[model samples]
Target chain A: MNTATIIAQEIPDIEKIRRDFPILDTKVNGRPLIYFDNAASTQKPWQVIKAIEHYYTNLNSNVHRGVHYLSQKATDAFEASRRKVASFINAEHDYEVIFTGGTTESINLVAHSFGKQFVKACDTIIISSLEHHSNIVPWQILCEEKNAQLKVIPINEKGELLMDAFKAMLDETVKLVSVNYVSNSLGTINPVREIIELAHSKNIPVMLDAAQAVQHMPVDVQELDVDFLVFSGHKLYGPTGIGVLYGKEKWLNQMPPYQGGGEMIKTVTFEKTTYNELPFKFEAGTPHIEGVICIGAAIDYINEIGLEKIDRYEHELLEYATEKLSEIEGIKFIGTADNKASVVSFNLENIHPYDVGVILDQFGIAVRTGHHCTQPLMDIFAIPGTVRASFAFYNTTVEIDIFVAGVKKAASMLG
Target chain B: MTINEIQDELIEEFELFGDWMEKYENVIQMGKELPVIDVQYKKEENLIKGCQAKVWLHADYKDGKVLFMADSDAIITKGLVSMVIRVLSNHAPEEIVAADLYFVDRVGLREHLSMTRSNGLLSMIKQMKMYAMAIQSKVKAN
Candidate 1:
């Protein structure tokens, strides 16, 4: 989609959306709840919650085994969820989507299965500095095991990936390139389309960790032409245990099965066993049935409201939050990427993020205060952690005002 | 009789120690108020993991009520531990489970704690609950 057209489509009604998430209505510490932990996991809407409750209360049975009505209903619903996930990301076929325990497991599945089969000694894998540990560690383990070289694409102080550095890293020996579509720590929306195209030009497979990006904006795998795209359900207002790993059909067919288990197998024998096709080959046991069903409901909810709407509202929230947070004395905002998501990771001068988080909690404001699983990124900034206030479509300008006031109070107390 | 009443009594008792900032003196004073656990009950099994400060909790179930004794190496945490034990101790397992701790905000201690210490408090409560659950399960098993 054209950038202008995308922006125009992305407007949301913030107050109306806030009501969908029941947890937002409660008090955290006597004060009203101000949830700023959207990046970690979003508060679930009624639709997603109802979907889970309905599944267990009505169609509670193991899928793909029994011919009984409950089992068939369960299997049909589960498969329908798979189809919904496939269409959500604009995958060519439903089989391209493999469900796992979230983005971490999705990345690990590719590393263990695809990496083991394809990556060999002397090969290279390229990753950016802004990657979450999930994106970085899996490749590091894979490279270490295969005796492959891991090349890092450096980021500028602004937290944007150096396209020149990325281009320089690419070569014929580069087996894979993995980068996050949006940084979890910095909220930098990476130019992933260019990165994918560059890697593809070198005939190297590209995997984009869309764990953070999928919530912020629409992810069209076909448009990007990425070899792999992975995201978690919880980050998108779904249940925690479910995640999606979208790979090209050719890659899916070529990679070996991740785990040997009942559901993933065609037959069981003492000597050898054949694996099931595409998704079933990767998903190993009786999966997180309720979580998967809830993810479908989440996707339906997002679709009905529209990704464009959510994206526009979140962008406004980010800009407002950034301006307000920047105004506070002794506050230094990190990751000043021009194009960014709704996260404002910052540190108050001389005050630990933990201390800042504690005082904020007194005001019933919940913000993430840690490395955000991006330790390498923390190392780049030469800090332990930042007080991260990540926004959602439901967040408001007034909430940002409250957050700023709370931050000001913390500063005075700590100072 | 109720968690709030116990909390009120604790606030009244804690005021005798003076400022909350003088945590070390407060700890010593609070320690004096703490009823002693049996010497035989003090063991490595009572220790909590992941706390930078040493904490030991011992519990005994009598007449379907669970009584607990807790101590910590750090003063503020010890005071906090004492506060938790005051309400939780000498309560039935079911009563302890039913008690809502959201009123902890009223203590005004959360602002003083770092996020890690707050997490430790949460972990301590979870451990207490787990202990209660273990006791309940054992009774069911019997």
Candidate 2:
């Protein structure tokens, strides 16, 4: 069968899905909102929003300590969310899942705590060129403090990791390998499973920065045998300020607690303090209670629709967008990895990405335009930035048509 | 003409546009018409800070008036640079410094003034005034 026939088969009810997000019904700049910045943050469905409201209204109490009724209920829901996260990623144990502020905090937790233990002077840490600043800066800080060296895995012209070079970089000096599962800037899906296996072969632990991965694909920690994995809640159709750090139980036991705070402590004394165990050791303070519960709700929402369907639907959308956008004259695609997610990063000839972004905004089409926190990648491409439009499952082909028209208009006006 | 009169004229000119596209078309036209900055003055030192687009601005004090020349890599930003230069250029330092640029809002381009916009038009306006002030101080010193 042809491409059109395959794409036409068994698509999700996008109109119904759009209704689940009330913001999709709203207008921006007197035109209907065309939200294409899903790679930044996905819109919260009503199920997730209602989960937040219900938590605050009915169960407004602290977890892990209070003996009262609401506290127990809140704690139950919060822990339930943790369990949901564990199963969502196929982690071996629920306790292995630690909650933090967001993916940045999660990565920092691993970088600081793991760095304090494993990384030392003359040691090396391997990260990729496609990393967001969150991943790069944390490792850099750790490397600086420990007098360790931070090595970068370079990418090809197609924005793919040079796997041979990565193999050469892995040696006894390397303590950890941290890389993004998906490139937020270019949408290049890294061969993380191969990366994990290679790191494991050399006895180095690998941490997959799944901040841009979890929402788009099914990630299994046990199956991938990943040492550590991190992802943000907001990007997964959940609330902000909540994220997950899935570490192997062995690593969690070895690494120190990220912060010294109330929940992170087992007992406190003037002389010395004992840190808590497993997940709470990293949690630190009173967590984002509602955000945690709503993550479970968001997972439920995704599970109900099914990731397979969302993945297929979004891939089709990406193909449609790519085909339509390619028709525009003087347009150059930035990242064209053989395998990509639902993101398109490109630029019009002689037009700054900022100008395209401004014009698209005037048309009420939301797109991200900048270095995308990957300035090193931008330097490699020898451009300032690209106009990136990332799609979620709720976006329709009609919206893509309008987006293409907007780009055509922008090209004509600016060309 | 007074800075206020120039601003009023700009506002009147922008009033003829039908929608955002037309307004932007006019802005792009103005940007295209803007005189190119001198290559020497377009160096790193003249580039405006806090602009998403690269904007190089240079000011010269000649005949007791501040003459401003500016350019930007982006057309929209260059247009905004042109508009700002129109209101403040070729005028006494004091007049340019004291002028209120109400035409931005009147032309429905207040969004460009927001720090979040990152267009650097706000920074450009501020830089223009600072140039005027610096020139004024230098004139007094002389």
Candidate 3:
């Protein structure tokens, strides 16, 4: 077989990849489990899981403030994870990576740190309608506190951003332009390269919420020249409660520390306290050390498979799924962007998405249903929600076939 | 009929269906046959909070028996609530409050609901019983 065929066959080996995820073998309601809720959180492979167990068992120690052997080992592993993430996103400096609780905390960190230093009264923050509440709410709070205005770049019915509208809104008063690289609800991939270049020409810093994008495809912060990018580890098949916020060094140096605590201090006296340097300045308290170490393993896992191959396989899977699902009567897609991810959001004729979700779960298929934390986007679409089946590379065509049959069963019962 | 008898009847009704798909189809039919509640009572206060799907349940007492009228945005939730109403409604306030709802387990519905939906179902039951208690207190006062 040729190289492409070899990789294609290996990338989506249904039985082989299924073994990596222990949960996939388990039965749900007496049927083999079919997990399509990857966007919610990806299941961990043995590589990532074993790494976490290895940390807790052999190397459990506090990082960065101890002279003991285990402490040094822990600190080394923690910082090594930072370096791994730094290269994973291709950041210019290792110190540019700041560990936060998750994507929410990372966005809030930027909103606090970057907002305090640069944003002023009458300054406007531009975000898209497709943003998760994490992205939208922090900016809203920042705008409220700073006496600034929050402007939105609306999307067309297809869920793609209206670049012309975004261009019209771009002006000197706009302090920052923030948009998701891939929409969590719609799977629509925004033209982030163009978005960054557009804002850069106007001398505005751009932030990307890559929570959904980084795992599905390759993301290089340096290549995109994105000022700030944030993503959660759990969504990338790693442990939950740990995530990374990558900031450009220039911006990191200019912005203030997000939270004041034990590790984030350079020097503290009774009168005055100075904050620590980049990465440490933003990270406060004892971090999710095991989560960090295992995320590094997760990155290693992805690299072994190769992101380009994974991306190619997922695109084909999405194409196949879309074509199969389209044949169902009364089925309508919510997002139809030309550039898309492995997310499929749809609804049957008049059945509520929640009803569809319940029926699908009965058949051992998992999907997300509701506004998906993008209530405004749901409002824009005039929908309560869409039943979302988000795929990962490990998911196969056979599972997609099962999902179609499950959806058909749901439609029959609900319609 | 007594609440136990009513629940037994539902269990008997569901026992006829050989498979989950057929049972679910019957549940959907039962949900569709549910009477609509007054539009005004579908407000936020009457809405059940624990459910993933919005379920609004309104209650009233007439001739010492409690009446429950409910509607849900999701058909499955509606179906579940309709069953709850059928077993408990038209009973005396004290009997409604004291009644144990065993039909859910007897009919094999406990396994089908998601964690959130199961919690919602429990809360819906609790809310119905709460309505019964409140009605009993008022009748005692008068």
Estimated TM-score for each candidate: 0.77, 0.98, 0.95
List of clashing residue pairs for candidate 3: none
Better candidate by TM-score, 1 or 2: 2
* Candidate 2 residue lDDT tens string, B2-54: 99999999999998988899999999999999998879998998988653588
Q: What DockQ results do all the predictions give, each relative to the true complex?
A: 0.05, 0.68, 0.62
Judging by lDDT, tell me the better candidate of 2 and 3.
2
Q: Which candidate is the best by lDDT?
A: 2
Model 1 whole-model lDDT (C-alpha atoms): 0.83
Candidate 2 stretches with Cα past 4 Å from truth are A1-8
Model 1 in CAPRI terms: which quality?
A: incorrect
Q: Model 1 Cα RMSD, Å?
A: 9.3
Which prediction has the highest DockQ against the true structure? 2
Cα lDDT of model 2 by residue, A274-372, tens digit: 988888888888889898899999999999998988899889889999999999989999999999999999999999998899899999999998888
Worst 10 residues of 2 chain A by lDDT: A3-12
- Order of the predicted models by TM-score, top scorer first: 2, 3, 1
C-alpha positional error of residue B89 in candidate 3 after TM-score superposition, expressed in Å: 1.5
Per-prediction interface RMSD in Å: 7.2, 1.3, 1.7
Q: Is candidate 1 or 3 superior in DockQ?
A: 3
- Models, CA RMSD each: 9.3, 1.4, 2.4
